[model samples]
Target: MTETTVTPTHASRTGGRHDEIRFGTSGSTGEARHWFRLPHQMEREVELIGTRLVGPVDRVLNYAPPQHLFGALFGQWLPRIAGVPVHQAWADPFAPLPVSPGERVLAVCIPMAWDLLRRSLPVLERAGSVVALHSSAAAPPTAHELVRRAAPLLRAHEILGSTETGGLAHRPLLPEGPEGGDAGPWQALPDVSFVRDAGAPTRGPEELVIRGPRLARPEHGTRPPDRWATGDLVEFTGPRAFRLVGRSSSLIKVNGVKVHLARVDEQLKACLPQTECVVLPLPDDSLAGEGYVVFWSGRGHAVGIADVRAALRDFPSPSQIVELAGIPRTPTGKPDRSALFAEFAPTSA
Candidate 1:
């Protein structure tokens, strides 16, 4: 999906108890989709997340932008509920200290923020106890490696969901844990329920259908009786825990064999986390169809084309492996796939 833009700026700027803030969606389909969230919706979110956070946290340090859902939760609703001083310093790692010794701080962070914090963990860790929260995208192994190195200095709580789904599940990580650097199984939020749809011949993986009061309604003006199907395909590990297998919309076919982009992403992340890797379809001149390309970014000791190919040997290797100073990101810190493809995609005559 493309970067989300706030709609009808008036309500977003002047929020009311029941006022709705609209967010526009632009994805593969050129058509636009709208999602509405009211102040009460955010309040419900703060109440749910606070069950695990509030009492333990003395202050809220939000680094996410206040416009988006996750950011609104931490930057606005959460602090309001806790009645604590709120701080926003997503760009700077040291935006004054959120807490002193013996006090706990609930810090909202994305993977990018953690990347910066990893370099100065010693000082940050000494400041106080932190319940570091992350969302928007999966935390890279490199970021987890940093947390593992800092052990006990801070605890990472990775929340999994999108703008449409307020908060689905979250997994806890420490400097040291059994799961380590891999993406561990996630437990669904207390109020969220999940069901898997039956697999069809055209589908690459089974999709997870969810039902919760917290999820946003569709802009198309249609509302299901109980649930909404998420784009993600997941495998249940236990009663409430599940692991993401792939995304139904992210499949690429090569000579009739299906390859999931999510699998490629996982393989690349397992092998190389210093740089972010995203697979985009390339033009296949011979077959008059589509091929795949691996575009990545980062510097210093970055992964080379040869290494990426070797790691993805078990899977389909892209036709090209390109690197940049950084991966293009959306306002919410997700890989801007549409933008990346446009910038790096090979043109055909």
Candidate 2:
């Protein structure tokens, strides 16, 4: 009898094996966890997202950080699954991407990146090959205007979704209007379904919940529900369309009146032109609860506490307003509300 030797093939150097999927998650309670996704699981995610994101002749350029879920799936895995040649820009998107003009280029960038591009509109206009600009993290309306003016062919889309659920929906940033607008309904890709709260009313402002094939399994020691309550509050504008109101966690009570932060944010932006503002709740001892505080970021803006209070007259009265050189933004460009409150809110001794 002859003994035969078998060689073991090592895992793919690109991280885990094609069969083993790795996911990084920060749960609703704000705990970080990682899980291994079976080959089939990852394949489903690719199938669900690829059809929506890629085109027959598209070439992707990703500047999103790979560590985050949106960035990992769309920026890294999706291209591999779709078999498209992606140009991973060495330079940050907040800065100019390393590539020059080329045909059929699909650009995925954050709002800050778009803002930078807007600042250099003349240079962007020269990159004629740019076709689509899909933005997430945060919506940059001003930058959207710049893109429209500089590159007519470039379409800007604001995608909606989070770590727990992948890119569940998208809205258009250009040709802004109600009917047949570029922003499509907040549609589930294929196998995904929105879980509604039975206790709540049938529609409008229901807790945004999710259940789908790609829905991640909860980690050990966590009382994970099969369906994820997204913590987002959404209103159904149409049968399939929804407008994100704000996070349920972000809801604050002022003088026994409930106020949504996003609503206040809208009022502030409407009142203070060209200036960006975020309303945060500060812990109050006298109130035996929390009070409102606002932080605004912009240049050449004369927004004052009085002006802000006047603007918000029709809305909830905020406790105070502080001027900031720039808002402390998350890596993805959304305001870091907690950080601001922690640093700025006066401590009661």
Candidate 3:
């Protein structure tokens, strides 16, 4: 392995019809581990996304990194299949879109990048029918509204899934709704099926077991079940759709009370509508072993811990409040959670 590269576990053999490439997890804990994917698996995933989301696209405007699932499909695979040109929007954030009016363009971007481009949506108004797909991380409904309002003809889709699952589901968010308004249950993509695990605890939310061709081959030494039981908790709204409760892993105990980190994020965003927040768990020494830390950003808006605590009386209080220009994120647009956690986590003595 190179100095900058740490090799992930996988087994591959070349030459002949037996050609296959496998990818390992980025190091998961305990018995549960991520699966390996073959090239065909990747191809099948891209096909599903292109058919359901990027239908007959003439060009791809990719602003996300090629390493990410959303970006790789748009930047490379989709463009290859569509015989269309791809403009590297990440190369120049403010540069004019390489698109014209009435053209079909699949614009792939992330939540953070969208926040910046949303301001310049007026310029993209002339840029033809853009099917803007936001993924990698959750995008606030306001971000969708901004783009929808600015580009009146823009088609918006929020793909809900991870690098491990490809794209499990996608919801059409066209014409955007109010900031705090719920968009309802997410409709699962074709070729995917969901099952509620029977072994999940009754006291807390339940886990959803997903099984599909787009999924990875069980690699870990664990029970290697046919279906992957994702940590994402959900409440069934319909047969094919479900409202995401939160990740089971995101649950923490505070003062003997169960607190959902996702709920904390939602409440903080609701209280401070203008500001963006990322709620993190820190080591609590007192009654609760886990203390909550809130990181928020509103540009020019000044938000204080006391004020936020006042706004949220029904929720548990945060042990700390950190305000910054914006939430720090990884190159792939995922929240730099480890960095955020490290900011307050005590260093070794």
Q: Which candidate is the best by lDDT?
A: 1
Clashes of each: 0, 2, 0
Worst 10 residues of 1 by lDDT: 8-17
Evaluated at residue 92, the lDDT of candidate 2 is 49
RMSD of each: 4.2, 8.0, 4.8
Model 1 C-alpha lDDT versus the unseen true structure: 0.67
- For candidate 2, the lDDT comes to 0.59
Q: Residue by residue across 231-263, what tens digits does model 2's lDDT show?
A: 878887765567778778768777678888877
Clashing pairs in 2: 21-37, 172-183
Candidate-wise lDDT, in order: 0.67, 0.59, 0.66
Quote the RMSD, in angstroms, for model 3: 4.8
TM-scores for all predictions? 0.83, 0.79, 0.83
lDDT of 3 by residue, 111-219 (tens): 6567656766665666667787877667765566666676656778788875556678888765544344776678999888987656754344667778887764444
> Local error of candidate 2 at 153, Å?
0.9
lDDT of 1 at 49: 73
Total backbone collisions, model 1: 0
Tens digit of per-residue lDDT, candidate 1, span 1-349:
2235554323433332235667666453235666766666678878877787444577777778766667777877788777777777765556655455666777787766776666656556655576778887666555567667765767678787766778888887545432334557889988899765445443335677888887765565433236767777777777678878777566767666678877787777767756667776664567545557787775567457678778789876565677777788776677777777766745321
Model 2 per-residue lDDT at 298? 62
